[model samples]
Target chain A: MDKVTNEMLMAFVDGELDPAMRKEVEAALRTDPDLRARAAVFEATRQPIASVFDPILNQPLSLPQEGLRDGTEQNRSAVYSPGNPHSRTPGIISWFSGLFQPPKTLSVTVAFCAVFLGGLGLGFLLKAGLVTIDTPEAGLVAFRDDGLVAAGSLDHTLEKYKSGSSFVKTVSDGRELAVKPILTFRDHEGRICREYEITYPATSRYAGLACRTEDGDWNVLIQSPIKSRPTNGKDTVVASGRDADTVDAVVERIIKGDALGSDQEALLMNKGWRGQD
Target chain B: MTEDIRERVIAFIPRLRRFAFSLTGDWDRMEELVQDTCERALTRHEQWKPGTSLESWMCRIAQNIWKDGLKSKKHRAQVSDDSLHFLTGVDGPREIEGRLTLKAVMAAISLLPPDQRIVIALVCIDERTYAETAEILDIPIGTVMSRLARARQALYAGLYDSDTSSACAKAEG
Candidate 1:
């Protein structure tokens, strides 16, 4: 038999040959020591990997036990099974089927990251007059620099900057043209945290922030009024009459970083007006 | 036919896992990938289109599931190769079944492009004919030949580095 090409030899090794061709290759292999050796090494790999996986066929799958079987499931068997109430994944997440929750970001961390990046950036940017930030009575997210990090392969989480003692309130015009504020959060690093919804009044909208004032009123830590995108008269970023709290282009900003640890966060919430006062 | 297929596939689970383990050096992940594939196929059975070989079709889905699950953030990173890969320090050395050489070969196989990998896994590991592999992949037979050729060369080179010394050296020499 003439010398076979590498492709032919590979095909032969894989048994993709007719009986005549197989006989020819077998004949050649008897004379070719190197070819035989090459075949042996290639063929040997199948056995080891097969041996490695053999137990899996017999082993019943435990969602939690074999969950780490996939690197993508770093959290282990918790896809459908919540470990506990405090550890439950966010309800909004359930809406997105087939969407990989970033193995890295928790819902609260996601909430803060969303609020901080959007709140701070919009808060500070609108203050500087680069963009107009406004909000209805409901707080809006104000992120100028929502520093978001990829939590895992899929989830992009953001880090918020808030402290238990200080929720920076940027006052605009004597009337406080910004929207209302809500609770605050302090990250593990002791930075402040905030959240907001898209709020609108008349022609304008605000991504509100969760800062407060010395007075009992939840202050507008920061707010940005969106210059509404032109639509087909019927299209809307803000529904004409209803409250629309969807995230805008800054969806990436909204979920990042380690969310505030529980103890300090509760302290700020419980002390709310007292802390600012 | 579908009922029979369901029965046969359930029976083939052990066999399929063997094929999967061959592709991936680790057992745990291999099983996970296969289960994901089967689950996906069962739910999306309408797409299976009876009469075609279920094994080839399922094999395609298994590879896709494997591809979906197989991602190494470190491989694409621009970090200097001089430093240990972020995972290297964490996972220790690669998990080889017995010899480091065999493990190295499996990693090489994993690195095959999805196109070639599809063909190789279907044609080689599953022992399907070229026509069967082509049908499963929805490509032409000539494409199968070319990809298989490329896949073979890549495995050959990956299995043995010309200047290096390892378990593969026995085959290289």
Candidate 2:
């Protein structure tokens, strides 16, 4: 007779055996104290693991946004409709929706403007510290008439540079916006999106992700605080959300597949994003 | 037809939430992962075969998202210290000595590698069969059995090992 291995014992504990094998194990256990004891241990081990975490089952999870739990396909489809900004196309929105998606309490700003930076004047103004963004708590950290200016510049730089490359260009205001490309990939929607770090002299530094919207302008997805540290005489940009795990988390959520290589990126840049078409 | 599938996916949310909590050990991240999994499952629900294991399918989606969102190879090693702290709080401080609090069990589960942890969550916690776990994890049945056995053995040692719990108790104290 084959000695009952731990695996077989576990199978018995889990009721995983057919009647013939189960009878065999039962017969073996009837005479073998050691095997029965071992089976008891395996069964005992499963109790805490299975039921210990059961409390969470009763602890009510705040339901997913209104549309998710309503049991209607229209509402469900709205959660990821192509036209919805919160599309889970590459499935990123679902991952960081808690952090990036604004709560119902705060009024969402949905201003769509078609403005392009044609010359260095906008860059100069952007460098001269004129842009201001409204903050609910801090009154106003920095306000820009158009949030798209800084986002657009970062987008342009990403188009021109490869991932892991950084360049500093002095604006007409004598200030520089250091643009560094960190990640570039197609989103769930098959649109090319890039994450970059931007440093504004005498202003603020930010890490942002911008996806190439159907229109020419990039849709600024989410911007989070970045902590800058001087490393080897160069500034190292560190994310400041969720213990600095935000960027990589966001990347993992939205990435459709492996990031685009240089050639693929160039091809994407030339053709532009069209929602997986 | 799509609405019917979405409705079924919604029914699985509570269990999915529990499974996500087991995997992430954080309330906020668990909710988000479940939400993401639901959205993805619905969006790609067309690919899912009808009359098959829907809950198992959703579990697979959640696991994939969790695996992808991990930051590094080390990130996949085990639950982090922060997560351990969070796990400890789940049962609160009212646990009597030697009674086997959920926190202690979670701590032990957290010590397993992420792969093993998922198997434990699906098989042991969610009560998925070995075949079903293999489907959710996309591993072979043999691999699921092997992993579960190792996970069970590790949990047994972690929970019953006097030295390990005493040390943990000291650290908590």
TM-score against native, each model? 0.38, 0.48
Which residue pairs clash in candidate 2?
A89-A188, A90-A188, A131-A143, A132-A142, A132-A143, A132-A144, A133-A142, A133-A143
lDDT of 2 by residue, A142-210 (tens): 234545423333544655556776644333233444567777898788777888776676345777777
Best candidate, lDDT: 2
Per-residue error at A168 for model 1, in Å? 66
Give the true-contact fraction for every prediction, in order: 0.14, 0.36
Off by over 4 Å in 1: A30-277, B1-36, B65-105, B123-131, B160-173
Give the lDDT of residue A96 in candidate 2.
23
Candidate 2 ranges beyond 4 A from true positions: A61-277, B71-98, B165-173
Report the lDDT tens digits of candidate 1 across residue range A1-277.
7777655665665567788997787767655767765554445333222222222222222123233223344444264331122223321112121222355643543343233223343353334443322222322332233322111100100122123221111112112121222234433332343544332333455443433333333333334554465467865544342223332323224434544455555444333223321
lDDT: worst 10-residue window of model 2 chain A: A109-118
Per-residue error for A47 in candidate 2, Å, reads 3.1
